[model samples]
Target: MTFHYTRLANGLEILGESMPQSRSVAVGFFVQTGARNERPEEAGVSHFLEHMVFKGSERRTAWDVNRDFDAIGAHYNACTGEETTLYYAAVLPEYLFAALDILTDILRPSLRPEDFDTEKQVILEEIRMYEDQPAWSAYDEAVALFFGDHPLGHRILGTVESITALTRQQMLDYYRRRYLAGNIVVAVAGRLDWEATAAWLAEHCQHWPAGATPRRVTPVVSRPARKSVHRPQVNQEHMFLLTPAPPVESELRYAAEVLATILGDDTGSRLYWALIDTGRADSADMSYHEYQGAGAFFTYLCCEPADAAANLEITLETFRTAVRQGITEEEIRQAQSKLASRLVRGNERPQGRMRSLGYTWIYQHEYRSVDEELGRLRAVKREHLSQLLEQYNLLEPTIVALGPLAELAGTVFPAS
Candidate 1:
């Protein structure tokens, strides 16, 4: 495998990783813009614009674009997050150029007024669908409670009112401002002749606009507290414990991973044994989200309304136990092995390699080989996890729940 990183004369950075043994290729466009960059009223515009990108473009009708992708058997999709919007595709190595062509054309979108109107309704429906799902709604509310009005906590899918009020002109202006060459990274992975692929991008993207780089995201103010939502629509109560944590570039990230895995790994970690194994809850797990300058540690639980408080207590107690008694040597070794093994296995395919390329460039701004990444995790000492738990106070959580929890209002779950 070999890697190439270049900055074109126009300022767009093209980053790629080539593994000749792989039969598939994945390509992605990572734009450094999303809900966090939006004005207060433009909550959903970032995601809305992502939809418009595919509705049409300068040279291809929406139908033509879809048909072409289908013709090549490309599996493609796009997503909007707190800090980035990505459009990506994976296909047989032979379809690499065709996939790249379709993706590039869409990124330079048409954003027609008619297309905007239709896509707006589709997006509204998507938001509604998510609203009806308890788990998704719970996580969104948890983020809001944790970060308050901070841009990092803003909803990726803007509220119905926000999406409804958005205008085509507003979206067009946003597209121009955030989709600048300097603010975008075109990442690809798999077997491809670097010279030919680079030349193709240079020619096809020559007309791509070069604009001022977008400003850095403002730092977030974390409001560490608890809040609850009463949703009569669901049978289970959904609860999340969110805490502020280190950003993506922090070396503590490796330790954080081990911490989460040791405490709440779904297969049979502490939480699974304390909660799921005993039937205290339906499902429980812990995860970490590392944004550019903002990050969060989350523990999510779904259970009957009657079991909500009890299960939350159990989850908190598990953390306290780990902190007070210390993570066992065997547990630390197991977590490290689990995390390192995943890192090695995940990079075997182009799709996984593609994510590594995009995320490495976007957050770390440097690339580390898979072996190097595994080594970093392996090097993390048990003391590092202990230090993070003590110094940063990960045991005291900011709680958010959605369900029939009117009785729990004005009440924060006890940490003990």
Candidate 2:
């Protein structure tokens, strides 16, 4: 598959990946603004806006929006993450242009007050749902601990308080400010006519106002770690050990992936083989996340409250050993092969292709063909991994623990 990219004078990015012989096509619109783009008071606006768009658009009523896609058996959805919001649709190749048209309408929704009144309850329910999930709750707490008062620390599903205070005008204003062409990208894949699609997009999108460069914001710096938080109502402990790393564009980013893979990639991974297999913890894994301009790597673990300290020490020791001993050639080979294979399989679906194209377009501003990325992964050597760890030693991790356990009382001493 080859990915084609072009930028219009208005700065809207048009991206496509050709997947010959595929039965369906997927198209997506990605905006760089997400929870990280919000203030504390506007915490859930990004997600709320995502929902509102689907409720009604200029040309399509909410019922029509549902009927059109449902009639075609197409799949359409949107999601808001830390730094990006993606709207996508997957339908048979024949419906490609129609899907694109419908998506565009949704993006520039009518924002009716009736729709807002209806969707507010939905968004509030979403917040409550996340509140009840322990894994979700702990992960959010860890992010707050890692970024402190920074925008990155803001919860994606803002509190019910914040969501209640948002007015229709406020949301419309936000839409006006950030929905410009310069900050947007359109990614499409599978069977399609690039020339035709591009022409259609250019025409429909011209109504979108041109360049207004988004104001630059400073990067997040790790504050003192929040060691441990306890809610006695919980049955088990959830903990995170995080440390700073480089941005998505950095070479060290790949190394962090390799390190995370070795620690908790799968059943054979260090944490899985050590903690879970040995019954020392219920679940354990490491996650490496790279933000648009910065990165953080962490290990998240869950265990019985009594085993928290021993499990924490074990995870740290495993990581330290990997850094000092370096991964074996076989382990590197296995991890690389596993990652490559998964990448290939994941893109087989139209939805997956839409997501991959959207992600690359937003993060790199240039679409990286899947083949190119695979080659890079294949070329990664153990020496590269070792050099990365040596240069980017993240020994002083930010720790956040929650349970009835007292081990994580104050800040992890020597905040490092």
Candidate that would win on TM-score: 1
Candidate 1: segments with Cα more than 4 A from true spot: 409-416
Which residue pairs show collisions in model 2?
Answer: none
TM-scores for all predictions? 0.96, 0.94
Residues 256-364 of candidate 1: C-alpha lDDT, one tens digit per residue: 8888898889876999999999988888999878887767789999998888887887887887788788887888899998988888788988888888888788888
List where candidate 2 sits over 4 angstroms from the true fold.
215-217, 406-416
Worst 10 residues of 2 by lDDT: 407-416
The number of clashing residue pairs in each candidate reads 0, 0
Error of 1 at 410 (Å): 11
